[model samples]
Target chain A: MRAAIRSEWTKLWTTRTVWWALLGAFVLMAAAAGQNAIYVENGDVTTASVAVMSVTIAQLAFVALAMLVMTGEYSAGTIRATLSWIPSRGRLLSAKIAVVSAVTLVTGVAVGLLGGVIASAIVDDSGSIAGDAFKIGIYLVLLGALATGLGAALRGPVVTLVVLLMTIVVIPPLLQLPDIAVLNGIADAFPGVAGGHFLYGDADPYPPLVGLLILAGWAALAVAAGWQVLTRRDA
Target chain B: MSITLEKLTKRYGPTLAVDGLDLAVRPGRVTGFLGPNGAGKSTTMRMVLGLDRPTSGRALVGGRAYDSYKWPLREMGALLEAKAVHPGRTGRNHLLAMARSNAVPDRRVDEVLAVVGLTDVARRRSGTHSLGMGQRLGIAGALLADPPVLMLDEPVNGLDPDGVRWIRGLLRDLAAEGRTVFVSSHLLSEMQMTADHLVVIGHGKLLADAPMTEIMGGHATLEDAYYELTGSAA
Candidate 1:
């Protein structure tokens, strides 16, 4: 397992994708945070909501990173060589998941906190930076893991991108519609909605911990599906 | 270490890629696995390496299964297919990553790179490598572990005369050192020069497994024997 982690870390770090994705996540998250800082001048949104908005946009970078984690192997035909090294397919996939999750968590937390700080500074409103930023960072990591796991399961960049984007961007609005309260309640369990409540100080249907768990649960399902296909199907 | 596949079978929907394939790869010799396209050679090798699960039977390495080994790389070094490399990385970095996985030393990286005559191009991004250069890099990666067994698929697929001569010598030297070298190729001439033993399959079944000389004995040539074996199936 140590060897596996080292190998994956080397692979991830050596490639330019990791840095590019990190930059993309930071820019998107900072932009979102910057937009929310404007909300403070307009007095239309609470400080907490603006703080959360920054993390929300930042989480998209995690999604992008996650999508590339597994699908990149397929795109390059490197997965065959990878499996040849570690024949225990399950162990190999688990190691990749662990590495992807750990890296995403660390990066997401650091980037999320950085974006939140800059946005809050711009608005002159330091709402729960010390207390909530940590929680918000953890939330972004979970959301990133969920996207990574799903992207591996789907095995295509475009398909995983569409699915993740739809789940994150479209589901929330659909839930807002009338007569869809039940669906809305379920959508709250989605990684996007759950992450939203964690970052922003909103009236969450569930606690931040629960939201994180919900996202984790989605990631677990995605990983399990991916593992099954990975082990059973030809690479 | 030796690799053995016993009645190993794999079926993809209605197509049977490998059918009850049975073979043993011994130590101290280079064994060439030959077959036509879609003859299940790759599938069988995948099962032997434990990359693909056989629908029936088993693939064992040195008596136990592949996953049973404490460290599989310590037993065998494999480059199962051509160009199975991460394009985004340099040739050196790609091998370094694999070495890290198997706990191989950093110095071995440069040694293998030099062994395959890729030291000059080691720092270049692998995506830009020509097919022949890619093959050499793949060979370098396999040699990194210095394992007892080596399985390479089409190792000489896209090589110039000099590159081919280098690999042929390398394979013979590795086998001469008592390591088991199992290579797969469609070209009889390539195998004729390198392999001491031959394992031929046709239409997902073993056609012949014998010493190269014995398999070629009384036959016009190795190519003639290969054509005779696969002709009916084709």
Candidate 2:
């Protein structure tokens, strides 16, 4: 397991995709936070809120990074070599999840804290940092896990990105617009909604803990399905 | 070390890729795996490497399944296909990752790169490499762990004459050191020069398995024997 993790770490950094994704995420986070701080009414939001909102856009870059972690191997035909080396499908998937989660956790915290500083510098009324950075870190880790699983299951960047966009970006807004009980419930159940509730501290339907658990559940389910496909299918 | 296939069978949705193959490839000699296109040479090697699950029976390396070994790469090394690498990564980094996966020493990466004469170009992105360079990189990977068992699929696919000659000498030297070498290629003349034993299949079925001299008997050349064997099987 340790060897597999080491190999995965090396694999992730040896390519240009991870660095580009990270740079893009940081840039997006900074721009969004700065814009929100400058343009929005000072009393309408806090520095933490600005950081949280900024992450919604920046998280896409991290999701793309996570998806590529698995999809890249499939596209390059390197998965066969990888399997021949490690041979244990479950261990390899676990190593990938661990590596992706660790990197995204650090990236999310860094981006969140940096964005908060940018917002607080621009807006006088912006609130304190508090636990928002840590929350964003956790959210991004689960989100990264979810994307990695989807990448493994889908095995294509475009398809995985489309499905993730539809669920996390497109479908959630439409689902929330109806305001019906079932529609609201379904929207709340989605990982994006649950993540938002957790990050933005919305406790309407459930506590922040429940929101985190809901997103975690989705990630676990996706990873389980990915493991199934990975183990059963021929490389 | 030896590769033992026991009743190994693989079927892909009504297409039989390999049908009940049973053979033991021993160490101290080069075993040539030959077949026409779609004859399951690659599929059989994939099964041995645990890339593809066998539909029935098993492929054993050194008396156990490939995955069962704690350090499979150290037990067996393989080049399943040319350029089976992430194009964005440097060839050196690719080999380093493979080395780390099986706990092989980091220095071995440099050693293999030097052995394959890729030391100077190892830092460049593999995407920028020519087909011959890519084949060399793949061979470097297969030799990274210095395993007792080595399996290569169509290893000479994209090599120039010099690269081909280098590989033939490398295979001979490796097998001379008592490592089990299993190489698959359609070039019978090349195999005739390198292999001590031969395993031929046609349409997923074993057509011939014998020593090179024995199979070459009563035929003008290795190519004639191969055509006669596969042609009759077809």
B89: Cα error in model 1, Å: 0.8
Give one digit per residue, the lDDT tens place, for model 2 in A1-235: 9999999999999999999999999999999999888765545554346888888888999999998899888988899999998999899999999999999999899999988898888877667665788889999999999999988898888999999999899998998897899999999999999999999888789998899999999999989988988988888
Put down candidate 2 lDDT per residue, B1-234, tens digits, no spaces: 999999999999999999999999999999999998999998999999888899998999999999888889988989877879899999999999999999999999999999999999999999999999999999999999889999998888899999889999999999999999999998888999999999999888998889999999999899988888888434
**B1-234 in candidate 1: lDDT tens per residue?**
788888989988898888888888998899999998999988887877777788898988888887666577778777776678878889999998889887888899999898888999989889899999899898888888888888898888899999888888999999999998999987789889999999989878888999999989888788988888778534
Compose the digit string of candidate 1's lDDT tens values, residues A1-235: 8888788888888888889888887787777877878877578776654556676567667777777878888888888788767766677777777777788767766665776687667776555565565666577666666666676678888898889889888777787676477887887877778767656545658776677677778777887887787877776
Residue A60 in model 1: lDDT: 68
lDDT over C-alpha atoms for residue B47 of model 1:
79
DockQ of each: 0.74, 0.87
| Clashes in predicted model 2 | 0
lDDT of 1 at A199: 60
Write down the lDDT of every candidate, Cα atoms only. Answer: 0.80, 0.91
Q: Which one wins on TM-score?
A: 2
Q: RMSDs, each prediction?
A: 1.9, 1.5
